[model samples]
Structures are given as C-alpha cells and as structure tokens.
Target chain A: MTRIITVALIILFIITAGCALFVPMQKPVEQDNRLFLWLPGASSVQVLSDWNDWGGSVAAGGIIDPLSGRMEKDDTGLWTIDIAGLPGGVYRYAFYVNGYKWIKDPLNPETALFDGRTVSIIMFTN
Target chain B: MSTSLITLIILIAGGTDSTDVSIIPENWVFGYDCLIDASACGDWINNHPVIDSTSVDAAVSVSAVSPEVNFLVTGAMRNDSTSHVVLRRARGVVKWPGTPWIAAGVYLNDQQPFIAGLSNPVLEWGWVDIDSTKGFGVSSGGVLGFSGDYLIQLTSGDTLSQLNVHSPWMGFAGVDYSRARIHPADSEGVDITVNVLSVRGDFRYFKPWLIVAGAEGEEGKWAVSAELRELRPIDTQWGRIEIVPGMHFAGDNIDLPGSAFVPGQRIITLGAFLESRRYFVSAGIKGMLDLSSDSLSSVSASAGMISEGGITWDVIFGYYADGDYRAYVSSTVSDSYASAGIAVEIIDDSTRVTGSASYSPRDDVCAEVSFSGDIDDSLQPECVLAVTTSLGPVMCLVGIEWEYDSSPSLRMNLTGLFK
Candidate 1:
C-alpha cells in the first residue's frame, strides 16, 4: 500500500510541474483596422468626428450631434466604443460625456488644433 | 655512578634547590631516589612536575590547599568593606551512543537573591539528535519577588513546540503547539495547519485552517481555505470571489504586526478578468462589514483595461462608512510615453493631478520629467537624466536631477562582482 501511494504521488507531482512550467500563454493580437476607445469615471460618452457630417450637426463652428454618436458604458464605470472597417484617412474626434461635457481623449496622444481648441486625432489605414 | 660522584655533579650543575633533580631511566640508583620523591608529590606539585611510568597501569596524583577567604586584588588597592563575596558550584554531563545525546549543567550562587527561600540557582539542559530529526532545550533563572525568565522549545520537521512556562511576575505558564502539512494531487493541492495554545491564567484556544485546491479532473483553477472562524475561497477561470467571515488572526496566514488577530470585521470581495484577441478588462469590488451587526462598513470598486497598440487605464472609487467618497483615475499611452492621473475627495473638495513623460534619446541614456501637485496650484515638475554603462564585471550609473525648488544634483553609483 505504501508503494502504491508513493507511486501515485510521484505521478501527481510530475503532472503538476508540467502544467505549471509548460503551459502556453496567450498573447494579444493587433487589429490594425479597428480602434478601441475607453473612458473611465464617465456617466456617458459619445464620439464626435469629422466623418459622417460630424454625426449630422454643427453648432457654433463645432459638432454637437447627440443623436447618433452615443457610447456604451459597462457596470465598472468604463465607457467603451469600437469603430471598425474605416478607409485610409486622418480623422479628428473628441468625446462628449454626460450629455454636456466635451473633452479630448485622455489615452490618445495625437492631437490637432481646431477652432482655437485642441481636439484628438486618429489616423487609420486599410 | 657512585652516590658521592652524582651528588658532586648535581651541585656543580646549579642544583641548589631541592626541587631540581633528574633521574636516569636505566640507572637503578637514580630510580630508587625518584620513587622516594614521588611519595611527597603533593608538596612539590605546585612548582615541580614529575612523571614515572612504564605502562598504563602506573598512576600519579596531586593535591593543593588554599585559604577559603580570598580577596579580588587589582592594580589599584581599595578597601574591601562593602565588596561582594561569592560562592559558586557548577557541574555538567554529556552522553553519547544513542538516538539522543544529552547534555546538562546547573550552577548555584549562595550570595545571590533567593527563590522560594532557597539560594538563587539557574538550570539549563538540552538534548539534540533525539531521533535523527528532533531536539529540545530549556533555560530558567529567577528571583521569586524581583525578576524571573524562562524559555523552552522543541522542534522536529515542520512541527514546533513552545512552552512559555515562566515570566517575571507571573511565575510559570503557557503551552503552544503548531504543525503544517501539504498534500499535492495531480493538478490540485491541499494545505493544513493546526495551532493549539493554553495559558495558565488565560483562555485555551484551538485553531485549524485548511486549504484545498484543484481536485482531480477539476476545470479552471480554484482554491478554498476554511477555518472554524473564517473562510476564503477563490475561483479564477469563471470569476473570482473571496469572502472572509468573522475576525481574522493577523499573522496566521499573512504577516501582520501587533495583536494576533484583527477583530470585529468581515470582508467580501468579487473580481473577474476577461480577455480577447485585442483587449483585456478586469473589475473588482470589495465590501467590508461589521461582524457584530449587518450594517455595511465600507465599499470600494476598481476596474482596469488594456488594449492593443499600447493603451491602458484604471480607476478606483471608495465609499467609506463615515460619509466620505474618493475617486482616482490613471492612464498610460504609447507604453508610458506619456502618463497621467487624477484623484478627488468629495468630502473635502480636494483634487490632485500628476503626469509624467519619458524619452530615450540614445541606446544607453534616458530622460524623464514628472509633475504632481494640487489641481488648484501651478504644476512644478522634476526632471531627471540617467545614463548606464558597463565594463568587464562592472556596471555604472550616473543621474542628474533638477527640481523646481532645489538645486541640480548629480549622483553616480557603481556595482560589480569579482570572479
């Protein structure tokens, strides 16, 4: 009985060590044509871009369309939106949060000056 | 040689002192005189040495006598009116050729303070190699009304025995024993630990914490530890929840200072991680409660995300039972090419903002600048430049810092190991 228990223990150790050391780790894959955006601690978020007629409105030389440029928020207070299948071009965009506050994307570093204010920019290619 | 001739030779060889005499091994005449001196060996043993033996059976003995009262004389002479006189006796023993080799010693000082009306004494004993794996030792010394102390321990393999039987004012007292074991299955494992303690004037308690994880054929990774007073379980693949109920002993599982356990608090935590080809996100919530009641004590929530193309961010919100709320957000872009963070407290209307940027101008040098302060005040940044270089077996680092309110400082450090 002791020998059988010892043999079983040896086999178990071998399997555990193999799994801990040899298991393959997953790596993130880059999606060149897709843009993932996130904004934390925001009640709501929307993307205002130069494309799609700036979501169909122009107020005081700025885009103010709240109807078609909405972003979704998850339970963790993170607002995220994904834009896919865009043609090759340079686009300017900003975020509208809580139906009133308009701000630049804090995660995106590329920015351009527009109408005496700084706006975020995204360059996409097919 | 003739006796007259030997006597003359001895006088000529400066043998004026009777203690100076030599005996020849083969000369029967000198051997006869040597035996005569051996009979008075005690008188001359202090200044003269003599040994005469041809086999192990031959033996010699010596003795000395001195006055019982002696003074501790030093270079500086002083009166001995109030000086302390001491009388001490000590003995020790050692044994071998068994599983355990025992050694012990005892010392008594008649002039020392008394314990239980007896002369103060100290006892110490120890046994090692008890069974190829065990050993025990103890020491104690004390004055009944003033000071006392003792320590006793026994150790073997993963088990420990501690006997806290003596203390200065409390006399003798407690016993604590604990042991740990681990059993590993194919893809899972179990760990168990038991602690038992009893004190003469205090409560007796027993605590056992058991943890089991990863049973055979189990999916994902899961672990659970339960004690008679508390329980915690974690499951990672689907989601993770850790609930700790009742008061927890501080250093029982993790190291903590002060009391053995923290009382009157319970914690429940929930968290999950989800990852895909392009993005990874995680969220967690921690709730604390008053163990004596059902009232909510405090709550905190945190979430984070990382996406392709070097973007990451995290945020935390805390609501304390004292009606205070705090929120913090931090984000990084381009693998920390630029990073920014903000913190706000609702009760005091205080906010802090911080940012930093890093640039690598050359392969061996990098420059970075960071700024942080209250949001209502102007930002004052600190800039640093660092360079690293290496030579055979030696590495060197040089850095320069410039802060808004301080002079520029240059620092250099070198480290190496020799073969």
Candidate 2:
C-alpha cells in the first residue's frame, strides 16, 4: 500500500508538471471577442478616453468616468480589460494607475499629441 | 456559518461605488499562525483566549483616487464565549502635486491591542509640507498619542531634523529628536545621524550612528562600507564574498510607543555570503545575552544552485541551542513554471514536516496546495488547496482544507472593482 501511494503521488506530480509546461494556455483575447489590453505592476488601472468625456468630471473629489469601471487585473500582476462593440474610428485614450498616476499605454506605442500631452490611440474598422 | 453569511450581507449593504472589498479568512488564519511561530508564540497563546476562537478580517478601500479612504473591520470570538467586532482602521489621505509637496491624512487605528503587550487604539490627524521644505503634524488619542505627539520635520539640501514629541494625556511622556546629514568627503560617502531621547520629562539617552562607504578598483568592482553605532565591523565585497559583523547594546530604554523594543540584552551577529556564476552560499550566527546571565545562540546556513535552463534550488539548515533544528529545501522548475518547497523541524525526538506546491495553469489563474503535520508520529496531515482566478472585472478565490481530525471545509471570496 505504501508503494502504491508513492507511485500515485509521483504520477500526479508528473502529470501536473507536464500539463503546465506543454499545454498552450488560453490567452485573454482568445476567450473573448473584445479587444484585450494588459498593463503590468499597476495597483489599480483605469481607462480614460474621449468617449468617457476624458474622465474630467470630478466626483467625490476625484475623476469619475464610465470606462474607468471596466478595467480589471489578473494573478500575474497584469491589469486586463476588454472593449467590445466599438465603432471603427480612432480613439484617444490613457491609463490612470493607482488613481493619481497617469500615463499612455506602455504596451501600446501608437500615440498622438493631445492637449500638449501624449495619449495612446486605438483604431478600429468595420 | 451564519456569522460569515451575515458579514457578507453587511459588506454588500455597506458597499458603495468607491468601495473595494477583500476577504481571505483562510489565508488570514494561516498567516497568523506563521507570525505566531516567528514571534513569542508561547506568550501570545498564554495571554489571549486561543481555545475555540475564530478570527475574521475584512478591509474596504473607498475612493481609489487622490485623497483615498480606507476602512478595516475585524471580528474575534474568545474562548470565554464573548465575541467582539471592532473597526480596526479608518484612514483618509489627500495629496497635491508640484515642486513643493503637500499632503494630509487622518487615521484611527485600534488593531494593535490584539497583539501581546500593547495598549488601546489611537486617533490622529496631521498635515505635511505645510511649507515647501518644513512641516508639522499632530496626533491625539491612545497611549502613543498623549500630549498629542507633535512632530516637526525640516529638509534642507542633504540635512534634516526629525523630532517626535509625545505628551500623552496620561502615562509616559517624552521627546525624541534626530539629526541626519549626508555628505561626500573626498572619495568616500559619509552619512551621520545623531539622536537624543528624553522620557519622563528628562533627557536620559543619546545615540549616534555613522556610515562611510567607498568603492575602489576599476569600474568600481570593489566596494566597502563601515557602520558604527555600537561598533559594527567593516563590510567589504570584492568578487563574490561579503562579510558583515555587528553588535548592539540594549542597556538603555529609548523605545517609542507602538515600536517593538527588547531591553536589557546585548545582541551580536556575524554573517558572510558568497556568490558565483551558478552557485551561492551563506552562513550566519546570532547570539543574545541578557542581564541575568542567560544566553541564547542560533546558527544558519544556506546554499543554492542555478542551472542554465533557469531552474533554481536552495537548501537551508538552522540550529538553535534550545534543541530546535530545521531544514528546508525549495526548488523552482522554470520549464514548468512550478515551485515546491518542503520544511522539516526536529524538536527533541519528534519531527514535523510541512510542504507546499504552487503552479500557474495560465496567466489569469493559479493553484496552490500545502500540507503540514507530524511525520514520525502519524500520517494524518492537514491539507489545504487554493485557487485564484481573475475574470474581467471580478477576482475570485476558492479554498478547501481538511484539517487533522476535523471535517473538510471550503471557503470562497470575490472582489469587484467599480470604475
């Protein structure tokens, strides 16, 4: 019985390790049709875009916007969000990290000069 | 079970758009156990009601933006059949950006009482950077807050004055002031800090600290530093080996409220570390002698190897004069992106074994399993399995555990962030 238990444990360990190494894990974008975006090492990340009035309206002594609610993070310290069903056009956007720190998307290099500051851009088609 | 359900209901009702929720009852308990083992567990167990006691903690972060607000609540049920629910932490901070920084915050914390040898909660409100290079803050409430603990700090170039004044409403009162300066003298870097502490309305103690570090050889390959407070030896590092030695005197009492201080004991420590391209080793010894002539000593050694394929493994061994010997091995297989570790403790004649394994199945999900129990006596071990996953705007955690001589239990937690 002890030998059998040891063998079982070894087999389980091998199987788990093999699955982790060989299996192609599903990407976030592959699981959904929306455009998947990722940002790393951000405590909290939010999307600010022209569609959400650039998150300029101050509420509760801070900026509030519709898109800010859509951002989420995963286990790998990567904040991910999906934007679906948007019209085919150029959209100006930026990311707000930890509420106050703002910057263009580090992953997406496509940027444009907006309001004397650089902002990220995303293009969509029909 | 009913209590947990009620807590969840209260959380849901009290949640707001700015509110964020986190729950980890199982993880919290496990962490508490780890802390108990590291600190004076015997004293803690003896002082607190440990039998049939349950602990639950929850925190909410409100207003994720500038001037953030947070609230933490904790619940505990003692063995005496009495239950208590306390608001452990409530704080808010506001920030302003520019060349001259300005920030303010207010806080009320009551959680310190849960630990052994601590007093009541505290309420404090203060501001900083009222001036560009100088500012003041104030605190009130609690043993640490008597005389409202006025604070004044100044920054000018590489020198600053740090003052902590504690004039509490009752009990011990004192002031602690420290001056620090950083300067470059010739080819070396020098940092000096001097502190004067006065308690019971009298100046009673003084401490001075100095550190000088310099680099030599081409490309700054060799670096050396000497630190002196109570005679710490010089530390020098060249190619691979680094040595450090230090001694501390504990005869004087200059402890600040809310600070952990061990008095009337002298401590000495010496350690060395060596590293090469693919292997590293470290060893250390620490000893403490109290005024009563009682002494305790501990020694530890660790070695590690790193392979070209990114696999790394390490083994550590430690021995204490109190008849405690511990050995641990940890390995990470980068090819599989999995990690595992096992620890064994031999106390007297009995042996205890604990092990854990973790793997990330995907970028968004990870799973962990852990087991702990006596190895020599019985094979009945306590096991726990936990999985965490992120689904768009929501994060979820599920854990199941089978404790020794107890039925299996499952826990689940969910957190959502609102834009």
Candidate 3:
C-alpha cells in the first residue's frame, strides 16, 4: 500500500509538472492606440477608449484625430472613442453602435485581464 | 586529506550571510528574507512565509489590508544586497487542514525610501476570513498588484469542513415573447403566448468534507474531499405549473371511452433535488398537488443517473390519493389507465450523435434526436428534432407534436466549493 501511494503521488507530480512545463505562456503585448474592442457579434465593430468619443453622424467625419485624442467613427459601421490623452496607465473603453448603445469594441483583438468580458486597452506613452 | 579541504570550503560558503528575494509576475505580493548570519539561519528554506491582504488603499488612508488574496506560491528568498532602512520581522504559524493553506508574508522594501511620488505604494497585509464578498484595493499612487509566491499551509479547522451552498440572485426585468400553436395538434395556426420575465437570485454556501488517513510519519495518508450541493429556485408570481393528462382511445380490446377524457391542470409540483458526484446521480422528491376539479395530493420521487460512458437514465414514479377528476373519470368511464415513464439517453461523442427515448404505458412514447457539443468554449449550439406519438389505448394528443425550449435556461448560483 505504501508503494502504491508513493507511485500514485509521483505520477500526479509528474503529470502536473509536465502540464506546467508544456503549457504555453502568453507573451507581453505591445500596447498601442489601435482601438480595443468588445463586440461579441454583428459584422462591423469599433472602440472608443479613454482617448476619444463619437465624431457625430457622418462617416468620414467620425475618424478621430490621433493627436487630438478624438475617437474614430469609420465607414466600417464601427463606433469608437479616443484614449490617446488618457495618460500612460491602462485605460478601458467600449463601443457606441447606431449612436445609442454603450458596448465593447468587437474588432480589437487584444483584451484586458481585469474582467473576462472584452474591453479595449490603451497604454499611453509620455 | 583533499576531501577534508573540500568539506571546509563548502562549509564556509554555506555560512555566508545573504538576502534572497523573488516575486511572480503581475500580482503584488513579494517574498524576501535576510540572513544576518547564514550559519545561524540554519535551513532558511524550512521556514514558511504567508501573506494576506485585509484592506485596500482608500482616499483618507495611504495603506491598508484586504481579504481577497486567493493565490499561493512556494519559493525561498535570499539576501542579495541591502543597506539603510531597518527590517522589522514578524513570524507565526498559519494552518489549513486537508489542503495546503496559503502562506502569507510581506517584506518592507528597506533600501529604497517610500518617496511621496517615486515610491510605489504596496497594499497593506491583513488576515481576512474567506467569507467576505467585497474586494480591497490600494491607495492612490500605489501599484495595484501583488508579488511573491502564494504558500498554502495546512490546518484542521471548521472553515475547511463545512458545506458551501449558493443560490443565484436573478432578476429578469424584460418581457418574454412566446408563440405557440393556435389549436391542439394543429400546425397551421399560431397562438400568442403570454409574455413573462423572471427576476432570479440565490444564496449558496459550501463546506469541505476532507478525509485524511495514515500514521503520523507515513505520507500514504492523502486528503481527498467530496462536496454536497442543494439548490432551490425561488417561486415567482409569473411562474406557472400545469400538467393536464387526457386520453381518447378507440380499438379492439380497448374499453370504450368518450372522444376525450379531459382532466385539465392536473398537478403542481415544488421541491429540490440532491445531486451526487458531478451530477452522475440525483434523487429528489416533489410535492404533487391535484389542481383538477378533483382534490388530490401525492408525492413523486425522481431519480436521474448519468454514467461516464455517456449513458443517461431517469425514473419518475408517484403515489397519490384519487382526486375528484380521477374519481369522476373512474366512475363515468370504463377503460381508464395510468402509468409512469422511464427515459434513456444514448450518445456518440465522437460523431456528435445524441438521442433520448421515453416510454410510458398510459402516456405517449417520446423520442428526440440531436447533435450537440461545444465547438469552442464561447459558442455551443444544439439542434434537436423531436416527436411524441400517443401509444396505449389513446391515439389523441392535446398539444402539438413538436415543442421546444428555445432558450437554454442557465441557472447560475453561488454555492458549493469548487474541487
């Protein structure tokens, strides 16, 4: 019985260690001004982070200025807010679709670890 | 003579004083130790350091402790280089039986001054009982994270042995839109279903039943535990319970009955179930009250089992006092019948084939075939085609042959400890 228990423990340790060693770790992401997104469905999506807000009704006028920290509203039916001026720390924001709903950006691929729900990240540079 | 010299050199190296420190990524708990004298420190690795957060930084306070630390680390520290600030040391024993308790510790960064602007504030450490739901944070300008390896110490205590139960607090403020067949068994017309949305919530608690067996020195003693779960969904004014059983049978050997034997709204049920071992088997009893024009009361027992091999079965049986409806039907009708049902589930996990069949002597034979499984954690869709044919002496069905619960009702409750 002692031998069996030892073997079992050894097997468990090996399995756990093997799993840990084999498990791929996530790489540190390069933070940028590209809009973070949270849209789960729907064809087109965009983000509005700490940097920018809506650019009004027109499509071309919706593009936010990078320096001015204006949120972009592109022709892709995506809604965006700007986080360019939000400082060096991490800033979270969502999407504004059809001018009424506050939602996360769908198109942005990178996500924040704080909540499992999707949110765009804006790591500002001095 | 050479071995003696080597041993002396090794001893000298081991006796040197040093400071060792390390911290895991992202979290803010840091572990460190100072060996004023290495030889005197003995085996420093033998000492366990545990840390806990009892509060977060608030507007008025610069540092505090919080009760939400949930990770453990197993690592040692050494003194590398140090000067300046005095290091105050505190030590104690923390215990958690059955499983390793999280070892908690905090090291004040002595060399670097806690400068107003440059100093990255650390969350203060505190002991928190695990029952609190509120989380702690740090003061402004302090880093929002933890460092160091979480160490789990083992202790025998009531906190580790109680059943944790949880019920979800659910609230549905929106309206429900339902569409149904206009006429019984008629597919051509559609009926407007009443709109009702439910507000849901639950309270849950969990306790661990840990088993440890062995002599003091033997590691053969292992700790394993099983958790028990009990859940109940609160009733709402909008909830409805309706079970109407009627039959119309015409054939040789089948006693003559009217075109229909209608006992509307036959029963209402309320109770909870006890599921064991990851829902492999569950036994439950529900109070069944007669709602027909007749007065009847009875108790129904239900048992459901699912095997690891993908076989599923369920049995439901009940004993009830004859109600007014049952008495009326018995006195007025000659060929009346009653029966129970058993359902069996079969699945081919690889091919994504799933099906279930139920048979009742007095009721109808119900069967459904579906293909369901997760393509990914984010999206899982199931499509089932079902049909129920009236068997026995009755060839009549009051409802449409096809019905489905479109929304996958997910009851999320806070209860029971996660193994």
Candidate 4:
C-alpha cells in the first residue's frame, strides 16, 4: 500500500511540474465585486456573464485581451473571461468557439462536463 | 406418448381457444379438432399433418381464451412467379370468445397494401412491410392476428401442417417465450426450432418481439430473460451484448465446419451503448469463448451512427483469435471486416421507396432496392417489392419480391368461463 501511494505521489508531482512548464493555469481578476477574465491566444471566445438574462445574449462576440484584468495567457489553450458585477448569487458560464466546439474553464473547478461532451461552469457567491 | 409427444400436446393446447374453424375439405382431421359451443361457426383447429403441397402451404391454430378476451391467429406461405407471397390476417377481437376472430385482423395479400376480411363497419388500413421474403422458407410467410388467446401454425405445400404455441399466458404472467419453428421442405420430417427462450413478460405482438418487452412500461424493463437454442441444420443465428459494468462479449455462427459445437457452442455476450435523438452513437465489444471445446475465442466492437432524418447507417468491426487448446489446424485465425449503408425515404404517404447498399471487406458487397405500398385502409396487409444483388463474383439475387397479409382468424363460438 505504501509503495503504491509513493508511486502515485511521484507520478502526480511529475505531471504537475510538467503542466506548470507546458500548461500554466490562468489567474482571474476581481474589481468592484466583479470578476474579470482574459484569454490572449484564443481565436474566438463567447462569454455568458453574470448580469445578462439567461435567454438573451450578454455579449455576442468578443476577442481575448491579454494585458488587463490581471490576466495572463499561459502555454495551455485556455482564456479567462472577465465577469463583472456578479451579484451575491451563484453564476454559471460557458464558451463557444469556431461555432461548433466547447472547452472548459481551466480555473473554475465547478465546471461540469456536459452529457454530450461539452463543458459548463457554475459559481456560488456570498 | 414420449416426452416429445407430451411437450407437443401441451404446446398445441396452449395456443388455441373455442371458435369457428373450417377446413377446406370436410371429414378431414389431420390434427386435434375440438368443438366448444354453438357460436364457434367453423372452428376446425387443424394440427400436425402430412407435407405434400406442390402449390400452397397453410397452418391453423387456436388458443384458449376467457369470455372477456377473444383472440385467434393464422398464417400462410405461398410462392408464384409474380412474387412469393405471405398473407396475414387479424380478423377481429370481439367482446366475447364465441365471437369470430376474423373481424379484428386485417386481411393481408401480396397484391397491395390493404385490409381484407372485415365488413359492416369498414376500418382504415395501415401497415409497414419489413422483410416478407425472409420469413418461411426464405421466400415468404403468412400471419393472422387476434386480441386474446391464440395458437400459431405453419403449413407448406399440400397436406403438410405444423402447430406451435408461443406465449400461452398473456402479459399477466411475467413469463413468456418465443419459438422459431421450421418444417422441413419435405413432410416426412419432424418440425424443429432454432431457439426457444422464456421471456420476462408477454412480449408477443407478431412483429419486433424485442419491442414488446419494452412497451409493457416499467414492469417489463430491467427484467431478464433466458433462452436455450439449438442452431444447426436451420442455419439461423442469434447474438446479444451486456454493457452495464463495462465489458463486452459477442459471437455468431458463420457456417463453419467440424464438430466444434456438437453439443452447441455457447456464446455469452456483454456490452452497452449510449444514444441520442438526432444522432445515436454506441460502442460495445463481444467475446466468444469456447464452450463446447477450447478451439476458438473472439472479441469484437461495433459502433453505429444515424441522423435524425435523411439517412441512417451502422458499422461493425471485429477480429477473432484461435483458442490455446486447439487440436488441429493453424496457430492463429483472425480477420476484420466492416459494413455500412444508407437509407432514404423517397415517398411519404402509405407508399414509400427505399434503397440501400452495404459491403463487408471480408464478405461480398450487396445493394438492395425496395418499395412498400398499402392499397387498403387496414394496416394488417401490405405489398412489398424488392431486389437485392451482390457487388461481387456474380450478382446474387437479382430477383423481385411481393407479399400480402391475411385477415385474422376470429369466429364466435362457445361462450363460457374457464375459471
């Protein structure tokens, strides 16, 4: 048992360090009780923000901004979308790119894998 | 009587009821004939008979039913140049047993898609033609429908008839069964079945037996059914998959030679699949382990894809491995093949045209064209025309097909309560 655990830990450590070098995690930004996300290298990114109604579009098409929102573009292919004026309630979001595929938010652990292989995020706020 | 004889008797009695039965020739009784009461106008439930029909083949069976439930069934197989035909009829399901079973089932014929054998209050006809030529001697078969208790019989050529009772106890009893019988081309032989297994519920409705189990609602789901079959001289096959816990198994008979399955090789398959509406995707593996002898083992995976409309397709690929305890032949025997096809619905109404092409690299490629039309208002009988030809060595089966459904055998007779 000890040997198995030791081997697992070593494997985990190696993967984490390798990811740090190849796929760095994104950092989100917060201001005025709102969260700002940015993704630099993405060809296209659509955001489902906290303020807009679920049916209508909050923002239709938006390109990634690298410098602001305390955002950094890592080697991995992920973008952070700035979520502003997010209320005290829970917030959910997703990204649609190239008109046909979905990718998970690397920074949000609450994101779930859709039944059909897509990704979505849910947030709980105080 | 021997055990086989007793089994045969019980099977015959299980599918019949009191009704009007008629035999073309009078004073002729090839099988058991029971007259229940006055209403049963021509109730002649014919059973086993000699096989010597050069032109037509028929079988009539009756099942026991209570006063509230009435049912009867009959089927036939015939052949001609214009097309081989299979006629079926669901005569009727009257308020009582002694009532004729004929009024309920739609009379079926090879000429067109229309309901026959019903009058007084005409009904609209509806029917879908599947593979009419594949049933009963690879050319055509016959069937009749009724509401309640019933028996099934098959007769070919002249003077040859065989009776079989499938599900004696309707849906009330959780136990059910299916019997695939074949009467040899010659009447001198005894009738036999390729597979017979108890169903978890009453999944009997003449077509698509699998759908019956699922249609009974939650009660039928999650139920397990066991079956034992002897598939040899019949050239019939069956397969299944268990995919829940994440392992798969599959096996089939490709008409291989030898005593490999003298006692019959057992094929236990386990596999599962995931599907959606517009698009359906499933992946499962099948494993064929040596049951009779450790001569061969096989594992395979099958995947299928279909669109919401337009065309639907399926693909299967697998490989086989030789068993370790082989007594003769080579050290390894494995092969992989794939099949795919598309179907298009050309006409929308009661009549439609469909075409498909399929190929297996290991086997021969084939293409098929078919048309199904219903000329009548009743759904029981339909007309189908089809031609299938091979894309290999020589075009096989460039022939055409046409079939019909017969009216159900329903007649009013003995009015009573068995209980």
**Winning candidate number (TM-score):** 2
C-alpha lDDT of residue B228 in model 3: 20
- For each candidate, the alpha-carbon lDDT, in order, equals 0.36, 0.39, 0.26, 0.28
Candidate 2 CAPRI level:
incorrect
lDDT of model 2, residue B253: 36
Measured on C-alpha atoms, candidate 4 has an lDDT of 0.28
Candidate 3 chain B lowest-lDDT run of ten: B326-335
Q: iRMS values in order, in angstroms? A: 30.4, 20.4, 27.6, 27.3
Which one wins on DockQ? 2
Instruction: Please give the ranking of all candidate structures by TM-score, highest first, separated by commas.
Output: 2, 1, 4, 3
lDDT of 3 by residue, A1-126 (tens): 999999999999998755543332221222233342211122222344433322211111122211222234333212244344442222455554312224332222222321133344332222
In candidate 2, what are the lDDT values of residues B1-419, reduced to their tens digit? 12663455455444432235544222221101000000001111333422232332232222223322222222222222443433323334444444333445444331111000100101000111111233333333334443322333343332323333334323222232222222333345444332323222211221222111111222321111111211223333421343435443333432212111233434454555443322222223333333333344566666544333333344556677566767655444433335565666555566778787667666456576779888765768889776766544445556666777765665554444332
User: What does candidate 4's lDDT look like per residue over B1-419, in tens digits?
Assistant: 12443354455554343245632223222232211112221212253222232232222223323333334332323333543322233232333234332222222221111111101000011111211211111111122222222222233321211122233333332222222333555768544332222232222221111111111112211212122111112121222222322111112321111111222334343334332212222234445555545454555444432222212233334455552221111011111121222222222233222332222232222222233344346533333222222221112222223334432222221111111
- Which structure among the candidates has the greatest lDDT? 2
TM-score winner between 2 and 3, please give it: 2
lDDT string for model 4 (A60-80, tens) is: 111121111222223332233
lDDT of 2 at A76: 44
* Model 2 misplaced regions, further than 4 Å: A1-126, B1-239, B252-260, B275-294, B304-306, B309-311, B332-334, B337-341, B355-359, B391-394, B416-419
| Model number 4 iRMSD | 27.3
DockQ of 2: 0.02
TM-scores for all candidates?
A: 0.31, 0.41, 0.17, 0.26
Q: Please identify model 1 stretches exceeding 4 Å from their true place.
A: A1-126, B1-260, B263-279, B292-296, B335-348, B361-365, B377-411, B415-419
Candidates by lDDT, descending order: 2, 1, 4, 3
